[model samples]
Target: MSERAYGEELMSEKILFVDDDINILQAYKRQLRKQFDLHTAQGPEEALKLIADHHNFAVVVSDFSMPGMNGVEFLSEVKKISPNSVRIMLTGFANATNAINAVNEGNIFRFLAKPCAPEQLALSLHASIDQYHLITAEKELLEKTLSGSIKVMSQILSLVNPVAFSSTSRIKSYIKHMVETLNLPGKWRYELAAMLCELGYVTLPPETTSKILANQPLSSNEQTLFDAHPTVSASMLDHIPRLEEVAEMVRRQQSNFSDYTLTEESILADPSTLGGCMLKVALDFDRLINTGMSLPKAIQSMSNRRGVYYPRLLQCMESLSKVDRSMEIRPIYMKDLTVGMIADEDILTVNHMLLIAKGQEVNLPMLERLRSFAKTTHIIEPCRMRIP
Candidate 1:
């Protein structure tokens, strides 16, 4: 593999080396450039930008001492930016304390001393790449294969109880936006949790699902059933391999801010807690809007409920709502409905039976179902929708 600067096309190596010293970077290029595909960055800031643009790297090697940010700090940032990338620290002054800190805080895969032979560095790089492959392959299996099966099951369940799963797609979108807006790492876990958050709804009767979705006051018995959904969902997820963390997030979705003393700064450091808080915010926001509350009013209502939501997450939702409201809402006939359009109001049949809930994203199956219904039953025309 040829030695190239950042922003070049990725080759088989997918390896990055960051150091403040040009001499050291050049030396790496001179010695190990042929053995592996090499990319170089002068400092941590540049390396981070490169990772942001390029998306992923199999392995990242950084010098321990540098201007502004040290190796541990840089590697920590790398963990956020490219989590699948295996990190290694190579420095001239490696102490026991530094090693311990690097392992704990930075979560580095390996530590190497300076003046290391090319053969040793190459071996380390090979191991790091192998680790990267393991991480990504397992994620692929879960996301593609396992997640696909679960979604199909949810879709079938949605058919049985449309009211329960009506908001699943919308809730997933909300969580995805928050993850990006808040710059939270390990987004897949939260997104997968969002997808399966309503799995337990399948266990509820249609009447109970309707009450929960409508934000109606449930009876004591119904409320008990409602409260157990998160646990039921979490239990099901817990049985799956590599889903322990996602299960925990679903398990804690209904937890309140008063339950813990996490500050805004500290909350960012804990993804599991943050994931659960995000789920709560998304779920509650959806319920409020479904009750005919405006964007600002829904956010304000959530904020008024002290100790119920994480303050910063609510703020993020408010900001996202402003952006979402920019889309133009237009009236369209049933035939004009296409995929990805957001429903502005509940769609009902001629008999006043609810057909599609508000805030649901239009999908192909829904379109086909609507078409099939139009042939047999009369659906109210001129649906109010937000078209992008």
Candidate 2:
């Protein structure tokens, strides 16, 4: 329920410059120092350390050819670590083909030739910072759009996968309790993450979605697809630009504690933020609780798993889940709409008489048409009257 005003942070008001060449790094640092917090990196490894250290960068201008990890590899890593930071590549010998490849592969911003002009670097940095601003601005816009989208999607998901939707919402409700119980981030990141986490289900078939709802174990392939759902959801939102970061946290939510994997490495996809840890914990609680496991059992299982999730979050989930579901969420309905009433929440502005017509997409247009039909039919309320 606690949603903060988003995007108070302007953009990459801070910049980090990376190159094996100390001179180049220092030169840019000197020129852009006043405008940006310029840091130097001798190599990709060093640059990553700087990212971990400062934990913030508006833009990164890195060399193409570096020991161990090249520019593309470096930015790919950066993308995992810092979803919002803009990246540009600096190269000397690479051809247009190579640069294009790097840009596509790395998801880079701009390219600067080797021994670049001072103005060019400044301009790129300026553009990158502006790009950061644009990026945040876009995410904010989508967040607004999706604010309503989540409520609608949750309702759709309820019909598609009722148990999953209810369970997920319960987990979210409990997570909210935990957050308030502990005074967690006084921001909307957790709420936003929870709202969009189930988005990947959009791509899931009703049958496949059913199995997950049935709370049955998935096949290896199904499990893999489920694991990759975060990326799928991220891809869907990535194009919108504004939901990039939320999409990111959503994508990595399944990085649960595995005996074979490291949560820090997997959950720490973005080293710049600790929300990954929070998300991992949230997912862990959902996985355990949705299995009908109790909080003590969940905690014990987690302990046995060697800290795949934060215990504090688990504690909160357990604590909240106990008193949580007591709140009966009142269902909002239009009077003309019956229990079996099927009105499009989309196309139709007004509620009208509509039955759940089979095979229809139930989108905006169909709903609009149904509303028009409702006024015409003028059926009595679906609620039966008491014995009189």
Candidate 3:
């Protein structure tokens, strides 16, 4: 492809070259600095330091033979830390085996023999840049296009079953805090799982969803249906491309911690399983709080459930309760309600019927519905709300 075909945007992506010899590194900079936004490091150590400091490096080229770390080892670290950056290895004839290992382990995009022509090296760099763009473009499509469509579907479902979706919003917040507390990776998957977790509630009758939101007892038949909702939700998500992992998390959300029994090392080995564990904790905690249990009491109750959750995940809840206690709760009139405020308690009618569930965020549709209800039925005014 022509240089112009790559576009100025793609051509501007940063490139890094690493060699143990400072002279070879300087020679690469002198030869190709004008053609690429190039940076050089004397060895693998300096290269890793640069990688840690910089956010956007489109290509990383390293010599195979280094003082401490070989090209394969360095590039393997790059794969873990900056998987999107295209990796290329340069090696002598004797180091060809290592170059091949780099391709297998480090996912190296291209490798060049030492003493290569400048033109051939430039061509390889251009190819790697094109490859980087392709990788990023696909990721953008998944994040923007696919996720956007899912969000639109979620909006529709929210309108249809606000009680279910509102509970989803509250659970999502808990999941977010847990993910942050644990310093988990692939947070977007957990977020999306939380967003879509309640989709199956849309299939139930409005009363069934209301009973669930109110934490009321369900008939055996209703309980059977309720237990199957995760399966239904997972089935829907499984059809979407690139969402298989998220689907698995949804499917396994109801799994008991005792059933899994993964060791600390094994718990992190499978991110989807960990994600499911987070969802279980969040969902049950939301249920407890909806039953009017205080944050501390709900966490205490969860701790009492011997096989329900991991102790560390339960500890995250304890820390989260500290944040919850610090938040200010105030009373607001129905007409004064606005979006983004969370309901501190269940909004109820004068006759003791639940109108809105606790922990539900105030949204435009909910606000309008409450207003219409007030015109016909008496609502408990000066309702309690929490400032997030």
What local distance difference test score does each model get? 0.84, 0.61, 0.83
Residue 7 in candidate 3 has what lDDT? 57
What are the per-residue Cα lDDT tens digits for candidate 2 across 1-388? 1222122232226677777878877778777676555667788998888776555687877888888888889998888767688999888876988688777778888977878888877777767877887987887776667766665766566555433344454445554665576654323556666766777776776566657654578888788877777778767767764456767667666664442244444433332133545566666655565566776776678767764665555566556545221223232233433232222222122343223322112334334544565567543233221110
lDDT of 3 by residue, 1-388 (tens): 5757555655579999999999998899899887888898889989898886664799999998898898889999988768789999888854657766877999989878889899999989989998998998988777887777776677666655556777767777788998888777557888889989877887777788878877899999889889999999999999888899999999988998888867855786477888889899998888887676888888888898898887888888888744443468999998888887778777888997766767677766677878888889999989999887
Instruction: Report the poorest 10 consecutive residues by lDDT, candidate 1.
Output: 1-10
In model 2, which runs have C-alpha deviations exceeding 4 angstroms?
1-12, 52-56, 152-170, 173-264, 267-388
lDDT of 1 by residue, 289-335 (tens): 77778889889998999999999888888777443344699999988
* Model 1 whole-model lDDT (C-alpha atoms): 0.84
- Would you estimate the TM-scores of all the predictions? 0.73, 0.49, 0.72
What stretches of model 1 exceed 4 Å from their correct place?
1-58, 62-83, 87-114, 117-138, 321-332, 343-355, 376-388
The residue ranges of model 3 lying beyond 4 angstroms of the native Cα positions read 1-82, 94-107, 116-134, 204-219, 304-307, 321-327, 333-335, 344-356, 364-383
RMSD of each: 5.7, 11.0, 5.5
Best by TM-score: 1
Please tell me which model should have the higher lDDT, number 2 or number 3: 3
